[model samples]
Target: MYIPFDEMVDTSRVWIYQADKQLSTAEQSQIESKCNSFLQEWAAHGQALKSSFQIIHDKFLVISVDESFNQASGCSIDASVALVKNLEQELGINFFDRTKICFLVNGEIVEIPLNGIKSEVKNGNIKSDTLTFNNLVSDIRSFQTDWKVEAKNSWLKRYFQ
Candidate 1:
């Protein structure tokens, strides 16, 4: 789950493992360490200086950071993109791809198009504003239950689970 660094508000946590599994202490510690390292590397990114983080358990972690960085400073889009690129590099995951992910902003559905140049907002207009990864994660978590049910009922459920 990728939360934009800028929209991070209150600390957030999520489970990284299934509850049914009984992990050995070593395995659990390894997962925790990986999660911690993930957050640390994220915070170490150029635009992530003001961010703070903590790992609660093998399953959950919290990230607390200033939201002021949401604002782009002039023509520093390179800096902004660099932050994302660094995250992708560190995570070995593409966090900024819109094709596989969708965002709901203030009730509007926004999708990162195939081209990745801009997002297409559905059911509402797109506002000219920067959105943080934290905010997106929060929103998704809030609607997670509903999404889970919906996914289970759809053909995509096999792929998701």
Candidate 2:
């Protein structure tokens, strides 16, 4: 069921949820507890799924499953989504919005609206070397290595070009 995040292999499947705004300390604690409780009972086709989660920079929630043990079925995946939805409502946080781009600036998390990215880049706020969170990484290995990447190396590279 629930395992320490570090115990999951590098090949584990990863799902990243970005919060529209940074979470307060209380919210983070509440989220961690709720996730731990839900993951303990999370299963796929009645089989317990080995999984873990990480909350990064108070702005991202990463859930990973060691699919080698038991692949997450469609229903199981839906269950996880439902959990996120409920949390969103209860916490008044938006985790499903993909229209904001997150970047690490001076050790702070800065969010730029997707439609305003080009303008921000033009304003010299986002540079070719700006570290942006690539939430699209699908596995633990990539999540560790490429989750935070330079803007020029990410899909935003097109804008740089």
Q: Considering every candidate listed, which one attains the maximal lDDT?
A: 2
Please give the TM-score that candidate 2 achieves against the real structure.
Answer: 0.98
TM-scores vs. true structure, each candidate: 0.28, 0.98
Error of 1 at 79 (Å): 16
Q: lDDT tens digits, residues 14-83, model 2?
A: 9999999899999999999999999999999999999999899999999999999999999999999999
Which candidate tops TM-score? 2
For model 1 the local lDDT of residue 142 reads 39
Over 1-161, each residue of candidate 1 has an lDDT whose tens digit, in order, gives 23453455543322121111223466445544654455444432345434433332232233443445432233333433454355345544443443443333564333444344232323223333423122234322432333222322333234323
Looking at model 1, residue 62 earns an lDDT score of 38
- Over 4 Å off in model 1, which ranges? 1-25, 43-45, 49-139, 150-152, 156-161
Worst 10 residues of 2 by lDDT: 152-161
